[model samples]
Target: MSKVLYIKANAKPEGESKTFRIADKFMEAYKKHHPQDEIVTLDLYKEDIHFLTVEDVMVHMSNEVEEKENPMKRYALQFKSADKYIFAEPMWNLGIPAILKAYIDYVSIPNITFKYSENGPIGLCQGKKALNITTSGGDYTEGMAAEWDLCDKYLKTIMGLFGIFDYTTIRASNLDVIGMDVEAIVNKAIEEAEELAKTF
Candidate 1:
């Protein structure tokens, strides 16, 4: 069966986070379509995915010499096991959260997730897809605020390093602070997510 890795980057549990609610709706729709598919949810807030340090980089690079397996190795394995990936995060400081970035640092290793070649760095994890579900308090669709969207671009670039080019983004920007209809905006994001889940 196809496997999907859902990474929840929000620290808030349930009612406090609007991003979590949107992610839950997207996952529900995905489950309805692919009931038999395996779903692995990685809650970043709960997990202790430490930021990459110099020691960690050394361990990754000297794996052959050290010949010892570690937690980072396990993380890399888990990342390779997924056929599809889903990121649920809120836009923070025009970018993703620190936890998600930490996870990415752990997974993006040379000769594992990707490799350097003469042509360029080639992604080893091919034939995989990804979906990024994000919410922001600021309006960033197609206006003066569009250029400030760093979340989508960062996620896309990181996923592309693993050869995951087939991707979709579900964004609900200006949800809380827009002074507009919040329910309608959220429902619209849900509708978009449902449609995207069908294609996935």
Candidate 2:
């Protein structure tokens, strides 16, 4: 069975978060479709992920730091071993949450998730797939506002850096837009998530 890492980046709890609501449907459908697959949920807020410090960077740069001795190695190891990834978050100030970014940094270690090459940095974690489920108050998928969207764009770019090219994003947008039917929009995203989970 495959290993799926479900990374929850929102500060809000599962019940209050719209992003989680959609992800919940996806998880339910995904479980139904892939019962044998192991799903591991990493809740960023609850995990209290911290930003990398100077010592952390030094440890990563030094080959002398053993995997077991490094405080942050577990995150990278967990991330590297996963066959699939699910990122669920809400758009905050046109980007992702601070904890989520910190968690990404924690797992993006050289030689573990990537390595240096003569040409450039080559990702070590290949043959992996990722799905990004995000919610935004404003619509960022089209028109001029799309330029302000850094959440999905950044995640896709980072995933590619890790050699995960088969990345998909399911965005729930315009939920807070005035005069729009919020429930309808969310329900539509939930349906999309459910369908995608069937084949994901």
* Number of the predicted model whose TM-score against the real structure is largest: 2
Question: 6-108 in candidate 1: lDDT tens per residue?
Answer: 9999878887888888888889998998899999999987877897878888867854422326667667778888999999999999999989998888777
Q: Which candidate is the best by lDDT?
A: 2
Colliding pairs, model 2: none
Sliding window of 10 residues with minimal summed lDDT for model 2: 62-71
Candidate 2 lDDT over residue span 40-127, tens digit each = 9999888846878899898678665247556577788889999999999999999999898999888888888888889888987899
The per-model lDDT (C-alpha) reads 0.85, 0.90
Model 1: which residue pairs collide?
none
Per-candidate clashes, comma-separated = 0, 0
lDDT value, residue 52 of candidate 1: 82
The TM-score of candidate 1 is 0.93
